[model samples]
Target: MTTILVTGGTGTLGRLVTERLRADGHEVRVLSRHTQPYAVDLREGGPGLDAALDGVETVVHCASSPRGDEQAADHLIAAARRAGVGHLVYISIVGVDRVPFGYYRSKLAVERRIEESGLRWTVLRATQFHDLVVTMLQKLAKPPVVLVPAGVSDQPVEVAEVADRLAELALAAPAGRVPDMGGPHVRTFDSLARAYLRATGRRRRVLGMPLFGKTYRAFRAGGHLAPEQAVGKGTFEEYLARRFGQ
Candidate 1:
């Protein structure tokens, strides 16, 4: 059995991927600042990573901040390379190339690093997740004012699906930049907020406003939705149903 080291094993997406890998019978190890069975911090590189990566056939880089832009990924990439890790699988967001978001630019930088590293690698680009949806709901909980981008859209997918896809990548040849994974339905902020309200039985009103900034403009241009590459089975309705138990 191959040993797989996961970087962000405690996170929503990372946890699922690590669990899947462990379930697949691979010897899975977690890499965090906290020492455990096996751990390595990306911020500080060295023999620590080498020790954790011993006999590791694959490295699933799920460890990252919400704003995992290039500058952050650089250290991660350097650490992985120094460890001589075999297969490097990166989970990235969709529309990084199309959107002018700093986070996306950082993600793109890492992708370029792996491409030029000569190491076998796979980059799985996916859309937003239910976590983002939940967070948005909380952020816009104020009554009579759920401010949102007037015309921006989203196709949030299940984080579990993204995990499964990452596992599939680990088992298969590095597909380079793989197909985009999106939710079952295309929706606007208004629709998502309404669904969330109905799901939680909240009576908050939504205030649709114009999307500003380069990021907002990029999002409004449909740069985030990947109709051509979209492949998912979970819809927002089902997500709400499962979340609300209705």
Candidate 2:
């Protein structure tokens, strides 16, 4: 069995990835900032990183914050190189290259670093997660009137499906930049917010706001969409039903 180390193993996607790998009978090590024995802060290059990488043949990097991802990736890459890890797998957003947002830019930079790190690597870009979309809707619904960006849409995918795909990729050979994974439908932000409101039994007037900015324009233009790669089967309504019950 291959020994694999999963960074951010306690996170939403990473936790599922760890479970999948362990179920497949691989020796899996979970590394997080607070997890015991493998606790290592990737951002600051904490002390226990080297120990976690010991005998690890593959690494699934799922640990990411809003900021400091590049520094974390650099530290992880250097540690992986030192430990002679063979394969480095990264999970990224679908429009990191096309979207000009700061977080997207950081994700793109990490992708590039992994590509040129002189190590076998694979990168998978996926659409936004259902949880993130829900969070956005929650914030928008806080006000009496929900104000969503006009003309912007989101293709929300299941996090479990993403984790399953990552596990499969980790077991296979490094195939740099695999096919993008997208949700079943591309719905407008307004529709998704309405879905959330319905699921939670909240009544709110949803309005579209025409925000001016390159980011908003890019989102409106669907730079973040992967219409050709709508591989996910879960729908927002289904997710809501499962999460909040019928």
Candidate 3:
């Protein structure tokens, strides 16, 4: 069995990836900021990190922080190389390079670092998670109306699906820049808001607001979608039903 290390093991996608790897009979080490079982903050660069990477054959890096993404990636890659880790699997977002958002830009920068780390690596860029999209709509839903950006589309894949794919990649030989994974269907922000309203038995009007600047324009141009690489089978409706039992 291989000894694998998973960063951001407490987050949505990272948690599922950790579970999948452990269920497959591999010895998994989880890294976090707190003083938990395998606590090792990427920013701190503590000695616990060396212990965590010791005997680790592969690293499924899912840790992400928009403010310090580049530094964190650099540290992790350097540590892994020093520890002689076999492969490094990185989970990225689709259209990170194309999107003008700061977080996306940070992710793109991390991807480039991983590619040039001089180690075996695989990068999988996936669409947004279903829960994230739902959370966005829920947060925007107000008393009378849910405000959404006009002309923007969402192709949200399930977090578990992305986790499963990451697990498979961690076990196989490193493949640079693999195919993108997206949801089964792409829907407009308006339609997604309406569907969320119907599922939750709310009748809030969805107002499509015209947003300006490069971020909105990139979203409207479907920068976050991969129409030709829609590999995930989960749909937004099914995710809503599972989440809300509607």
Best by TM-score: 2
Stretches of candidate 3 exceeding 4 Å from the true structure: none
lDDT preference between candidates 1 and 3, better one: 3
TM-score against native, each model: 0.92, 0.99, 0.97
Q: How should the candidates be ordered by TM-score, best one leading?
A: 2, 3, 1
Scored by Cα lDDT, where does model 1 land?
A: 0.81
Candidate 2 stretches with Cα past 4 Å from truth are none
- Give the alpha carbon lDDT tens digit for every residue of 43-63 in model 3: 777678888899999999998
Clashes of each: 2, 0, 0
Candidate with the greatest lDDT versus the true structure: 2
How well is each residue in 1-246 modelled by candidate 1, as lDDT tens digits? 878888888888888998998899998888876757656557555567667777777888887764534544566566667767778999888898999988788777778987887788999889999778878877887656788779978998988889998988998877788878888778898889888888888888787888569898899998988877668888877888997886
lDDT of 3 at 231: 88
Clashing pairs in 3: none
The digit string of per-residue lDDT tens for model 2 on 1-246 reads 999999999999999999999999999999999999898999989558998998999999999999899999999999999999999999999999888999999999999999999999999999999999998888889999999998899999999999999999999999999999999999999999999999999999999999988888889999999999999998999999999996
Residue 244 CA displacement from its true place in model 1, Å:
2.8
